[model samples]
Structure formats: structure tokens, C-alpha cells
Target chain A: METTETLNETQLITKDQLLNQWLGQRKVTRRVLDAFPEKELFEFTIGGMRTYAQLTKEMLAMDGATAKGVATGEWSTLDEEKSELTTKADLLASWDESTEKIQKYWKQISIKNFQEKVVAFGQYEGTGYSILFYVMDNEIHHRGQGYVYLRALGITPPNFWEQY
Target chain B: METTETLNETQLITKDQLLNQWLGQRKVTRRVLDAFPEKELFEFTIGGMRTYAQLTKEMLAMDGATAKGVATGEWSTLDEEKSELTTKADLLASWDESTEKIQKYWKQISIKNFQEKVVAFGQYEGTGYSILFYVMDNEIHHRGQGYVYLRALGITPPNFWEQY
Candidate 1:
């Protein structure tokens, strides 16, 4: 039902929309992290098993992994091994590193290959776009959790829609 | 500087991060939309620009454009001529349509293509991955603006780090 012109336009728009969504999440995450009192970062929990600091650590690890994937042509898999970062500063620093890697790696993607499907890992197989979307979605979910953590700590995060 | 094994692992991690990020943004956007009084949706604005409703309409249109590109494997371009949605319902409906399309289209990407380059219009010309990141980043930028608008309206947005 869609013409070629229509489809082309959609692809471009989709790319932009996804990018915007990720940036918003990043801002929110940063605000949430900053709102936390250093003392509560490690012990704060809402759903019984969630810790504010632990979640942040996971976020850093995940971002690092995604950046690595983009940098290399190969998809990474999670082993039973849990990666750890000791402090907020360390986590933030790692996040910075991952962000750089992600930017560098993204520069390598070509138009022709955006839609190819390769099995990224066990039970996780989809086209390159899907995988990328998945990565973004995962961050958002965790970030939402971070929001809750901020609230429990009696801190108001920045507005979700704020651009700056 | 990185080994192949390390790169592969990072790729996998990146995919997860991307997905998480997407989910987080969606949650925040939904909250922003929900917080708006129905009548205010069409009139809300931070600067002199169009309101959140207007921006959402633009986002939906862009989604269609992005979908077209993925379906046809061609680069999508934006039209110089702009169109606007007249009502909140119209904008909301359009947003829904775009969300569905984005999800569907993302299923078509492959891991090997994450590094392939594409001619993304605008200031930067880079890989598909870069473009994807751009889209995510762009949404966040705009969403942050939405937050400022919310604050101006005296609405308390959810804490950015909340676990919900």
C-alpha cells in the first residue's frame, strides 16, 4: 500500500525519532543519578531486589557492551558472568567511554546493511535495526526504574520532556 | 586497540542498551502526553514554537518516513513542505501509528550491518548505527524541552530515576 517514496521517507524519520528518544533517556538518567544522595546510592531499593547503585552499574555495563558491538561488526553475548563497577564516578566514567565507542562504531554502518538479520545471540535474533532498537528500549526500562529510585529518595528528577 | 572477542561482546551489550533506552524514552513520552490537559495539548509550548502536540505530529510523520526507508532499502529524505495535525486525537493517533511501524520495521535489521555506513542527510554523514544513535539523541533533546514546558505549566513530572 505504501509507495517507494513513502517508504524512504519513513526510514529516515524513524532513524531520527529513535535518536531523539535515546537522548531524552540519557538526560533523565543523568538527572536521576545526580539526585541521589551518595549514602543512598548503594542501599536504595524499591522492588525488594533493586538497588540504586547496582542498577546504575548495570546501566554502565550495558552501555559499554552496546558501544562495543557497534565498534566491532560482531554481536556480543552475555555470559553468566556479572560485571561490576565500584563507584558512581567509575560508572559515569565507563558510561562516557561507552558513549564514545558507540559514536565511533555507528559511523561504520552503511545504508545497504541496515536491514540485514543476523543472530546476535541465543534466542535473540533480529535485523540490525531491531537489535539497535532493543538496546535503546532496554536502557529506557532501566532508566524508568531509576526514576522510581529517585522518587523514593525524595528527589524530583528533571522534567521528562526537558530538552536541556 | 580492541580485540575481536571484545568487540563481539560489546556489540551484544550495545543491542541490549539500545532497547532499554527506547523503552525508557517511550515511558517518559507517554507520561508527558498524559500529563497534558486535553485542551492544553494543542496549545502547549516552551518557546514561541508549536506545542508538544505539534512536535508529536512531526515525530509521527518522520516515523512514516523512516519506515519507508527500511522497507525499500533506500535513504529517506524529508520534504521541505510541512504539514500539521489539527487536533490532539489526530496527533495521538499518528503517534500510535508511528510507534507500531517503528517496532515492526526494527525487526528487519541484521547484526552484520550495524557497522555499515549510510548517507544521512543533515550535518552529519555516517553509518546506519550513527544515524540510529542520532535519532535516539534527537528525541531526548526534544523531550527535555517538553519537561521545561511541563514545569512552566506547574505539572510535576515523574522523577527521572523512578523504577516505575
Candidate 2:
């Protein structure tokens, strides 16, 4: 609501700072994925939650495509189904690819574009930054589940605040 | 990592912009909680997820306390267990109170303080912004599940993009 008003000279965060934060959390999440047993990664569910592997696929499908969509204003990206990669290795490979895609596409998004609203996948709509925040938030959401799943299975998640 | 280097001459997002973005998301999350059926708000669970009311309590307990914790280097604040709010109306009231607390405590935190490293609740540690980001991420994670629970319960969630 207040975003429409004239901005002050000082900024809350820089583009690089934001990206670094995202990437750092991503690293922690990757470790969370790795901490899981191979079978549990694909088969385990806690309290009606999806398996970690399926959650990873969901993140993979949306993030890279979502980044591309934001940079280009294309909505069809959401139509792409979640990655079908089954094995842990394959899933990690796909995850790494999406991470790269996010970085590459992120560079294409202008600072001014962050405030422009776009309809993502033709349903949920928000500004470029909000959508990006949603993607990051979505990843953290699933990752948090992974943390719980790990602890339930007697494994500890990676340090969440180790990103420096 | 890049924070150690010389600072940039211009900022990417102002302090107001960041706060506005956070408040906007909080508004969306509140709407999500409000959308739940009164009975389900406390008793409902989808696939092992906490009830919306419980999840709201977790958020309420952490956020305002976290803001206060950041403003002052206080670790004991984390010991304040989540509110035992049983009813939906009570939970919403607690939620409203925390929102106000966040606004009040947030102002006490200096911009420079955001970059300082401190241990929270005698466990997690990170720069001020990273810790704050974790709190926000934690909220969205639970809120996202609440959204799913709503869909499972045959209710429509508030538009996420409406935060603009």
C-alpha cells in the first residue's frame, strides 16, 4: 500500500543482499534434502505432508520457471508440471539446475520491475518482488517441513542461520 | 558474504518498502486464518499440520517476541512460551496484539542493528535481518499449509497477491 508513494533515499536492502539471502537459505535447504535417507526422501510423509522428494520436485518446477516468467511476463510457465525426476541424484541435479536458472533469470529483472504486478500461472497475481518472495517463502515452507520430517526420523536439519 | 565490502552508493529497497512488504504479507496471513471455520480453526488438521489457531499462536508467540528480542539483545524472551489461546476470537486478538507489538518493537531496532550478529533464545544466531527473515519465512510456511488446509476443507483462501 505504501509502496506507491515516493521512496526515501535510503534503502531497506540491496538487490545483491536479497539474492545472497535467498541463495544462502537455498544452501541450507540443499543440506536438508541431503540429510534425508534416500528412501525417506521419496516415501516419507509426516502428519499428512507430502514426501520430501515430491516437495523438492514441486519447488524445482515452480522456481526456475517462475523466475523466467517474472523476467519475461510469460504465464505459461506455471503450466509446466512438477519435475518427474525420481532418484535422489536426479532430483538434486534438477534442483541445482533450477538454482542456476533462478540466478540467471534474476539478473534480467530490473529494480523497477519489482513493483509491476503480474498474474503468475494465470491465477495468483502479485508484483515481481512479491512473487519472488513467494517462491523463496514457498521453498522455506517445504524446507521447514523437511526439517520436521528429519527430526522425526532422528536426523537434524542443517543450521538455518549459518548463511553469512 | 558481500556485506564485508564497501557499501553501495544507492539502495535497492527502502526501509519503509521492506516493512510495508512484511505488513502486507501479515495481512494476507491474517485473512487466511480468518477464512477457516470457527470449529476447524482450533481442531482441524490436514495431514499432520497444526490447526490454524495453533499455527497462529506459534506465529504470535515468535514474531512479537522476536522483534523485541532483536531490539534488545535479550535471549530469555524466547522462553516465553506461545499463548495458550483456545478460541478463534482469542487467537485473533492475540494476533492483533502481536502485530502492534511488531510495529512498536521494529521502530526500536536501528538500521545498523540489522547487520549486527546476536544469539536469539540462546540457540539460533545470525545477522538481524536474517533472523527477521526466518521469522517471516516461518509464518509463511505455516500460512501456506493453512491455505492448503482451507482448500482441503472446501474453503477459498484470501488472494495472496492482494498484499499489494
Candidate 3:
């Protein structure tokens, strides 16, 4: 397979940009959650699937694990039991906690540390780089679903490209 | 604003897993696209944003525009003109083209490349990253919107996290 070389040595992103991106993602997620009716959240699905609320619960579980990984710098050592977040408030609280944890951990990352190889668990073993991609990607994948859920309920989510 | 580090290394992601993740995203997108009513696609918005069709057009415009900074590589360029995509077929075709391009580029990336900084175009400013987290995140973010749109139309997307 042909491999592309890295971009020229450039500090392309600053701490502020990263922070803004994370915050923006959280903001969108909050809006999506707020727009849905509580009853519909658990029942809405295309095809045979769990509702958005179920997905939120799953996210809450993962956030707890990811937080542990970030706090200790040990991704492979985190537990995998599903955490139950039964209410929207619980989900939001969990989201806030995870966001705080992620923010704290992001600050500790240096440009050099991104390149360092590390082991990752869940859905086949992978490196730190790939694992991090999974974390962010998973959130996005579900967020898109939230939009569909919102539209079904006649609510429009904020623009995907807009900041704040 | 704090930045945190991922504990897992980059080497853990296998090619199969990466492909699976990409495929899964496409599947979810397709489901959302299928649910849209042709009439509502162009003007639909949640929270005062453009509809999925509008978003798709924006994605299409990124291709073949050097100034738009969405061209294959070249991250320093910037273009502000928003191109219009006339039909769903055109938008879908453009989406197909972009996905192919993205896959082609992604295949060229290796474990080592994930850690290197990359200046990706098509954002507020030409920002860079060691990992392609933003790209995947961007896709997922939009995909989530598709889900909401589907819900609003009383259509359900397939179970995204389910194993076939």
C-alpha cells in the first residue's frame, strides 16, 4: 500500500482551536438531546434498533471508561460494564463529566505525544492514533442519528458547520 | 481549555476495522438519504440550518475548487464561494466521488502517518492534526443530522451499532 508522508512541519492547530472544537461538539449534542421528547427518544428508530436514548446510555458508559483511561493514561486497563443513565438529566450530567475529563486530558497532550505508539482495546486491537479517531468518530456517528431523530419530531438541530 | 492524551497507541487499528468503520458510516448515511422527501431536502433545517441536501451540496462543492481549500491536499488555500448542487442524483454522485477520494487518500496512511500533523482544508481556517479525527468526526457529525431528518419524516435509519 502506498503511504503518504506527513505535512510539512507546521503548528497548524492551537489549544484554543481544539478546545473550541470539543465545546462545539458538546453544544450540538446538548441541543439534539434537548430537542427530542422524552418518550420519543426511547422509541424512535429506523429499522429494528435501539432508540436515541439507548445510544445515549451507551455513550454514557463509554464516557466513564474513557474518563478513566484519560485520567490514568491507560486505555487498555479501563472496565467495560455498561452504565445506566435513565433520564435526560443523567445523560447530560454524564456528558458534562466526560467533556471535562476529555478537556483535561487534551491539555496534557503535546504534539510529540500524538506520534507515540500505544495499545488500544475494543473492536479489534489498534494503535492510539486509530483509537482516538474511534472515540471522536463514534460521537459524530451518533450525533448524526440524533439529527434524524430530531427531524422526525419536527425539530431542527443547529447547523452542523456552525460554531456555537 | 485543556487538551488530554489518549492512552492507547496508534498501531492497534487494523485495516479491516478501519474499513468497517468507514463502511458503517456510509450505510448510515444511505439510510438517512433514503428517508428524505425530494421536496424537503433543499430547504430543510433543524435550528435554522440547511437541510441534508444543502449540506451535501456544500460537500460536493469542495471538490475541484482550489480556492475552496477542499481539493485533495494543499491546506493553505481558502475559498468562500458556496457552490450549488442542483439535483439529488448530482449530489449523490458527488458524494460518491468524494468518498472514493477520501478512501484513496486514507489507504495511503499508515500507523506512523496517523501521528504526524496534517493541515486539512475545508474548515474555518486551514487547520492541521496528527490524526484524521476531524475528518471522521465531520462525517459522523453530518451523518447524525441525517438521522434527525429521517426521524422528522417518520422514517427510521438502520440500527447503526448492530452487527449484521
Candidate 4:
């Protein structure tokens, strides 16, 4: 406790800015989601791995669900039933829904809440900030897979740096 | 500015914890980096895409370079001369160097600095926090590529969720 208290105390950035920064990642990720060719999105795979569309499903399930949990102090297991997505359009529509959910639930998180501890998705015990970073990190990790899939399919992916 | 002013301020986590979180990521990425076969590390490409080893070189260059720049208010383009790595062992060694650089430079960052904007690498401009997130996001994105490549070669990747 003394160490925590002694470490430092500063906002660094506002909560809104943090949210916007996260939203920026989501936007850029959305573009990556869009860049996939339809048939390839759901069917293409390297070796026996799942397709990029399948990877996006995991992201869609986590992004909003985890944030909403952090914001409201409620953790639900990943709802695989709800995420039974089939096509790229279905996945994109779900992505948009998750984005809306993020926007709505994000405002519920005061700056103090970011420091509060929570169990993400009913597992992964950590602070809200770490959990948020986890969500973003997971998306980025999978998005990297999407980029590989696109390249393998002879398609160019959206520029990784362009998130705006 | 008004909203920024109104938000409550806190560190949420310690510098050591944050660095560990990043190191945890690097550790996972290192496993992914190691999973690549010798030939596949440099030559395997999906439709003319850069090899996984080449992708990792980009990660090695950016990860430390960006954070070091933020810490010292100095931005230099990636030291490709240093990252002229070829073998997987070479890449992993550079990865370790970057990890050390992250630990060393991370301490130099005060809490207030995370809020200050900087032109990372003399190019991308954003707050210290955003820039840091960018560094992590980039790594995750490319690691995803490594995962695909591993799968394409019929090699199982390290579990994506496990970072410890």
C-alpha cells in the first residue's frame, strides 16, 4: 500500500481523451475489418487456422462486453451464442454494435473507476486500466492476424498506422 | 480543456507494473518470434508479404526507439543499422535489447509527461500515453502476423491469451 501511495499521483490524460484514444484504435481496427474481401474474410486460413472472420468474432464478443463490465461492475462470460456470426457483413454489423456499446458504457467509467480492480469477462483479475489495455491489445493482436490473412489472399490490408 | 480539467487524476498503476505489462507482451511476442522456422523466419511470405522475421524487425526498431524518444524528448528514426538482424536468435536478442530500453526509459517518464503531446520519432504526434499505446498496438498487430505465419507452416503458436 505504501508503495502504491508512493509511486505517483497524476492524471496524465483525461478520461475522455483516453476513451477517444481507445475509440481511435477501434476506428482503425474497423478499417482493417473493412479491407477484407467478403468470401476470403470467412473462408481464408493459413494451414488449419481459423479465418480472419472467426478472429473478429472473438474481438466482437470481447470489446464491448469487457468494457460494459468494467463500466458497470458486471462480468458475464463471453456469449458465444450471440456471436454466432457467419459473414463479413454480419461481423461488421456486430462490430458497429460493439462500438456503440463501448461509447455508451465508456462514459459510465469515471477516472477513479479506471484505478479500481475488476475481473474482466468473469476471469482475468486486474485493474480497469489493465483490463482496458487487454481489450485493445487482444484486438490488435487478432487484427495482426487479419492483416496476414489479407496478405496471404493477395490483398493489401489497410495501413496499420492509419486509425483515424 | 474544460473536460480535461474536470476529470479526476490518478496513476491507476505503477511504472513498474506498466513496464511489466509491456514486458509480458514482449515475452509472449518472443515466443511467437521463436515459433517461426529458420527458413520461414525470413523467406516465408503470403502473396509477397514481408516475412515474419522482417515484421519482427519493424517491431524491434519501433518499440524501444519510440519510448526512448518520449522519455528524452528526442526522436530519431529507427536504428535499422542496429536492427540488421537475420536469424531468429538475432531477432530475439534485439527484442531483449528493446525490452531493456523500455525498462530504462520508462522510469524517466513522470506521470505528468504522459499527458504532454510529443511528435514520436519526429513524425507521429500524440500524447505520451497515446504514443505508448501506439507502440504496444503495433507490436500486437505484427505478432498477429507471426501467428498466421506459424499456422501456415503448421506450427502451433503460443497461446494468445497467456502473457505470464
Backbone clashes per model, in order?
97, 5, 40, 0
TM-score of each: 0.47, 0.70, 0.59, 0.88
**For residues B76-145, could you state the per-residue lDDT of candidate 4 as single tens digits?**
8865444457688888888888888888898788776776779987778887878887788788888887
lDDT score of residue A49 within candidate 3: 47
Candidates ranked, most accurate by lDDT first? 4, 2, 3, 1
Q: Write the per-residue lDDT of candidate 4 for residues A1-164, one digit (tens) a residue.
A: 34323432454555566678778888878888889888887777877887777778778778898778888999878865444687777888998999899999987876677768897877678888888878888888888877777776777878877777
Kindly report which residue stretches of model 2 are placed more than 4 angstroms away from their true locations once superposed. A1-9, A46-49, A72-76, A79-84, A121-124, A151-156, B1-11, B27-58, B68-76, B82-90, B105-126, B142-164
- Badly placed stretches (over 4 Å) of model 1 are A1-10, A14-21, A79-84, A121-123, B1-164
Q: Rank the candidates by TM-score, best first.
A: 4, 2, 3, 1
How high is the DockQ of candidate 3?
Answer: 0.21
What value of lDDT does candidate 3 attain over all alpha carbons? 0.55
The model with the greater TM-score, 1 or 2, is 2
Classify candidate 4 by CAPRI docking class.
acceptable
Best by DockQ: 4
Q: Model 2: per-residue lDDT, tens digit, B1-164? A: 24411222344444455677788889988888889889988788754546778778778868887888888877565533455676777777877898898899888877666667878777887767777888887787678667667765778778855774
Residue-level lDDT tens digits of model 1 in A1-164: 24423333223333333444555566677776767777787776643545667766666655645534543556566542235555666556666676666666655654323445546543466556556655665565456555545654567756654534
User: Ranking by DockQ, best first?
Assistant: 4, 2, 3, 1
lDDT of 1 by residue, B101-148 (tens): 666766665433444455644434555555565565455445544555
* lDDT by residue (tens digit), candidate 3, A37-96: 877876777545468887776565555355345334566543333346667777678778
- Which structure among the candidates has the greatest lDDT? 4
DockQ-based CAPRI category assigned to the predicted complex of candidate 1: incorrect
